[model samples]
Target: MIDFLNSIDTQLFLFLNGLHNAFFDPIMYWLSDKWIWVPMYVFMAYLIVKHYKMKGILIILTVGVVIALCDQTASHLIKHAVMRLRPSHEPSLVGLIHLSKAGPGGMYGFVSSHAANAFGLATFLYFVLDGRLRILKYWLFIWAILVSYSRIYNGVHYPGDVIVAAIIGTLIGWGMSKLFLYIENRRLKNK
Candidate 1:
């Protein structure tokens, strides 16, 4: 079963990676780049402050915490444990993958930290901002999915790696959101 799934993953990776062109390459790279999202982060902070006032600062801080957890767990724990070779580094995929990296990626690519962090922030924001901004719930997931797709297009990770990271990241984000809410409710009760 694992072999079959891996086979499918490679085939899908090739198909998706094959579709990239010069025009879209830079865009995907930018989407996957962490620094490029600074504006988005600032905007998110503004949104939280606008809606929740002083308490909104807490949500912004929690987002950072959530992303840190997702990134560290995915990169340090899961990827090292799995040790799956990146498509760009896989011997079998030589001459087939479109290597788009500025530098060689890590040896293993089991769980993509990029996907984990992006989805983690998205899911956490969706939960914390629940009902306040209905549109953002869908937007956040779509943004996360786009960023995950960029990992496959960048040739550093397979679709399976991104998907697995997204699931784990979402779970982590959900757990954090619940924990935050529970503490908040308890504090309000005490007050």
Candidate 2:
């Protein structure tokens, strides 16, 4: 079953990666670049601070924790355990991948850290902001999806890698959001 699924994952990765062109090459490369999202992160921080004022500091800290958890779990824990070579690094895929200038990335790529981090942030913001910023709930996921897809387009990860990372990230984000809400309710009740 695992092998079967891996075969499909490889096919899907090729299909998605093959769709790339000159115009989107740079765009997707930048999209996958961690440094490129600094302004977005800053804007998100601004929103959190604006909405919660001083209390937003705690929320921002929690957001940091979310990203940390997602990144570490995907990049270190799971990748080391699974030891799945990235499509770009796979010997069988030589001369077939469309890697960006970012190079092949680290050795293993079972779960994409980029996907995990992006989805973690997006899911957390969606739950926390919800009605506070209705549009955010929708657009944040779009941003996450675009970022996740860019990994495959850049040929560093398989679709399976991104998919599992998204699931891991979403669960982590949802769990953290609930924990935050519970703590908030407890604090409010004490006051």
Summing lDDT over every window of 10 consecutive residues in candidate 2, give the lowest-scoring window: 128-137
- What do the candidate models score in CA lDDT, each in turn? 0.89, 0.91
lDDT of 2 at 6: 94
Residues 94-147 of candidate 1 have per-residue lDDT tens digits of 999886754448899999999999889888888888687777777889889999
Per residue, candidate 2 scores C-alpha lDDT tens digits across 9-127 of: 99999999999999999999998988988998898788889988877888899999999999999988999999999998899999999999989998899999988998898888777
Candidate 2 local lDDT, residue 58: 86
